[model samples]
Target chain A: MRPFEYASPNSKEQVAALLGTSWEQGAILAGGTDLLALMKDDVVTPRRLVNVKGIDTLRGTSYQPGNGLRIGALTTIAELADSKDLAQYPMLFEAVTEAASPQIRNLATIGGNMCQRPRCWYFRSGMGLMPMTKDGKSLVVAGDNRYAAILGTQTGAYFVSPSTIAPALIAYGAKVRIYSAKASGSGVRELPLGRFFITPKSAKEREHDLKPDEMVIELIVPPPPQNLKTGYFEVRQKAAFDWPLAMAAVALQMDGNTVKSARVVMGHVAPVPWVSDEAAATLVGKTITPDTAMAAANAAVTKAKPLSMNKYKITLAKAAVKRAVLKAGGAA
Target chain B: MADDRPRKPEDNSGVTRRDFMKVSAVGVAVPVVLGSVMDAAAEEVPIQGPGKVPITLQVNGKKLSAQLEPRVTLLDALRDNFDLTGAKRVCDRGACGACTVLMDGKPVYACAILAIDAQGRMITTIEALAEGDSLSPVMQAFVAHDAQQCGFCTPGFIVTTTNFLQKQPAPTAEEIRHGLSGNFCRCGTYDGIRAVALAHAGGKQS
Candidate 1:
């Protein structure tokens, strides 16, 4: 790695000032599990590394009586996975546990995982940042796109955001706290997890809505409903140390036997966590039987347009949703 | 490929003369002079590096402090700088658990963690498990059951098993398999490893 200056800031203000001054050439160093790998490969050549690990304010899991859980950005995956407050929010715990191997989870931070780069082979392996043609055409169309996007492929980039926790958080209606340096009165802003992602054409922006100099401080998960059932399931090629091929996060509120409300989101299937209101609509006021689950699974993928090699992912995604729904409904 | 035939001893004189000259030049006093110089250099160097970043790292029951690079991994900082070599570096990636160490009382792959991020946390390597020449109960059980082969992956397995047993001391066979799934042994010593964990859990060995 090229030599760069390092700063261990003690306060969020210090970090914000450092990042604000050096937006283009500076990188916030969280766990360094993902950022260091990107730097070592020269994918990102930041001239300054601001270490945020020293900030005591950005650590630990907190729970209030009515407001639910608020996890600091620096909290490790292992801590979130084993938290007692997550017993009622089983889908969140399940997603964190199924993310990576034990070692990666120990070093991977919740904020870092949500803000990680795409795992697209073409974008990661080559010299150029984005895979392009000689005439500057996107190369992902004809490349090895087995795990690429299935819904947002009409736009140029087909890479899926490799975050297992984002879908679960979105399903639970979580909110993110962003802190910026330039602003004085309103330095912080909160956005729902569903509105956090902007597509390439929509915003002409990055995968996430975070500003270059803004830092994600905390994530707030609303309290789980009283009669709620939740489950997370992922399909992987191997048992350990690999990303999921496709996954689903299912949350259901049941009134005795009939479904009161439901939220279904699919991971590794789009540029962001793909939420299907159609699937949720199919489950409302209906009993969670195998037939209803199959119908909801089919409705979830109705708008899905699979690429040539990823047609099998449709089936894998369907099975994942079905299994997640069944598990959440206590039928499996 | 061209020089298949053996050369005569006269042709080998060049090599012998060089070897003889090398041996004579470094005879008896050379080692003594070099050792003193090395000792002086070692004395001049500080025990910890610069910046002396304040970090409270509790390994076993002792609190330790060291100045290190921000990019230093927990595995390298422990093994190379602190001389805690029990956690071996096999793959260096997070794929293998040979470098497993307990951080905040949970078994984690040390290679994947940055040293700076491990501040204000408790770290436990395999070196702190036993007291002096005596072995811990888990280590004794491992020896009694012959649970290691080649012994490269023993420290990681032992540390993981120790943490697992602390949590679920009387784990069933299925739980044993599930808990040990994070680690891999190339020599296929898993059967013996499981036997030792089971034996220790059953109070069969001290």
Candidate 2:
């Protein structure tokens, strides 16, 4: 990695101030898991690194009765996986544990995970976010795109979202709390976690909604319904430390044997965590059975327009959805 | 606003416009002074460098000072500067656990951690696992079960396993396998490693 100026800020505002308003000037150094790799690969070379680890306030996970679960951005993946408070939301627990190796989980934070760059080889090989040829021909559309996005390909962005916990968080109705120097008053802003992800229209923009000057300080998950049941399932080639091929998270509000409401989110098969309203609609007011869950799973992937090499992802995604829905409904 | 809520420390000591623009000296469309803390005193933190900067690390019960750039990883610092080469550097990324070290009693990849960022944490490397003349229990098990072949990944495995046993002294067979998933052995010494881990777990061995 190239030499860079380091700033250890004690507060979120200082970090934002140091990071200016553009990606060229500085980058936030949260866990150093993804950022270090990007720097080493010369994918992103910021002149200054704003280390936010010194901000003591943004560190752990806690839950309040009325306010719900408030997880500090600096909480490590291992910390989240082992948090007793997360036991109530088993979908989140399952998703986190299925992430990278234990060693990585010890250092990788939830905030960094939220903003991690796409893991597309094209992107990693210094090809801009949207890889193009000399004459401006798209590389990922015809090239090796087995892991490219199946759902949001209508947008130019093709790389799959690398976050394992995003689907689960989105399913649980989580909100991301961002601290920006430009924000009015207290400089804090909260948006639904699903809205945090975006498909960049150009190479200069990021895949997430966060500005260069903003930092994700915390994640707030509202209290679940009284009869809430959630399940998360990921299909990977190996059981070891590897990214999932396809995954799904299912959250159901059950009225005894019937479903009152549902949220189904898919991961690793889209540019963003794909929330399927059709799948949710199929589950509402219907009793969850093997056939009904499979139908919902089928509806979840109905709109997946896979690239040449990724048609297999549609099958895996359907399996993931069926398994997650069944597990949430207590049918499996 | 909650009337009883404590006021932020930065509220009393206001951040000047000069400081904000001075720190962020780029194409900043909007410049605004901002600073706050939950409880820590509002003290100005000096920015360290692109060049070498002095930093002290708490490693293996010792305070070791070194002049290192911000980009220097903890693995490089431990091996090159401190001469603690027990933590190998295979697959410099966090994927392979060759450079595993215990940071604040948690096993973390030293290769993925910046030396400057590892300041206050208590880092325990493979060298610190043994007590003088005697090897640690996990090391003894590795020897007894012949759990190594090329021995390249042994230090990291030993460090990780020792920490794992500390947390779960009697882990099940599946737990042991899951615990050691971070480290990879190309020589396929997994059977021996599993045997050693099982033997170490004593009566609970499956």
Candidate 3:
């Protein structure tokens, strides 16, 4: 890592002031799991590191019947996995547990998880950042794109969403609180987590909607619907700690044996956590049988335009959808 | 690539490891601020540095002081300056747990932790695991079970096992395997490692 200034601010505002107007001048060191790796690889060379772990308010996870679940942005992934409050949210627990190794989870925070860059080898491998472009063209379009985006590959960007928990959080109707030095009045913005991320515009663009000076302060999960069923499933080449090739998060609002509403989101197949409204619509007003599950699964990948080498992801995504819905419906 | 290209450290689209537990299970309230519990009369003297900064850390029950650049990682400071070679640097990233150490009673990758950033926490490394010429029970169990091949990974496994057993004294064989997934053994010595953990689990099963 390059030599950089370090500051452990006591308050969120202090961190904001130190960060100034751009994180390119300074990077917030939350868990150091992602930031350090980015630094070590020479991908990001922020001259100052503002340690936000010392900020008091941005910590802990709590839930209320009326107010819903509020998880501090600094809450570690391990804590999310082990929280007794999350015992009923199997979709969430599965996403957390299936993320990184236990040791990495101990050092990773949900805020950092939200700030992930793309895992495209071309983007990460070369010393120069955003290596997917050369001579004003995308190298990924013609190169090895097996791990690239399948849904949002129309643009020059091809990196898939690397977050395992993002789809689950979106399925559960979670919202994120963004604290920025640039925001008005309270210096905060509370928005749905589903709209939190963006597909890469160019290879070098920030993947999320967060501004350069913004810091994710907390994640709020609203109270789930009555008679709710949720499940998360990931298809990984290696069961140990590998990133899922494709995955799905399914949550169904059931009216006894029939579905009243549904939320189905796919991961690793799109630029952002890919929500399929078509898939969700297929489950409404129908009993969660094998036929319904397969129909919903097929609908989930109906619009997935696979890259030259990524047709296999379409199949994996369908399986993930089917399995997640079945598991959520309690029919499997 | 253009020579005039702006130096952009593109994003790290996060990461994934290969250490999930098949059947295994499993912070206290850490006060968020370094000076939160301090005397109120003290001035709010903020310390910011991009250069060599002096820091005092309580490592293995001793207050050790060092002047290091903010970018220097805890793993490098321990192995380079302090000469604490017990924690080896394998995957300098957080992927491999070779440099695992107990930071505030939790096992974290030392290489990923910046030296300046880890100052206020209670950092424990592998060097403090035993008395003079006396191995800890966890270490003894490893030896008894012959749970090593190259021994390059032994110190990490020992430190990690100590941390794991403290939390789960009665882990099953599968739990033991899953718990030790962070530390990679290239020699395929997982069977023996599992045996050592089960032998020392104090006969509790679930």
* TM-score, B chain alone, candidates in order: 0.69, 0.79, 0.74
True contacts kept of each: 0.17, 0.69, 0.57
DockQ metric for all predictions: 0.09, 0.36, 0.28
Extract clashing residue pairs from model 3: A43-B9, A44-B9, A117-B12, A117-B13, A241-B17, A241-B18
Candidate lDDT (C-alpha), each: 0.74, 0.85, 0.79
Per-model RMSD to reference: 14.6, 6.6, 9.3
Give the least accurate 10-residue stretch of model 1 chain B, judged by summed lDDT. Answer: B41-50
Where model 2 places Cα greater than 4 Å from the true spot, the runs are B1-21, B24-43, B203-206
User: Chain A TM-score of each model, in the order shown?
Assistant: 0.95, 0.98, 0.96
Which portions of model 3 miss their true places by more than 4 Å? A126-130, B1-47, B202-206
| lDDT value, residue A84 of candidate 2 | 89
TM-score of every candidate relative to the true structure: 0.80, 0.92, 0.89
How high is each candidate's interface RMSD, in Å?
Answer: 17.0, 8.8, 10.5
Ranking, TM-score, top scorer first: 2, 3, 1
Clashing pairs in 1: none
Candidate 1, residues A11-125, lDDT tens digits: the string is 6655554454433456788877777667656777665577777778888887775999999999989789888877767889878877776666767788888788887877566
What TM-score does candidate 3 reach? 0.89
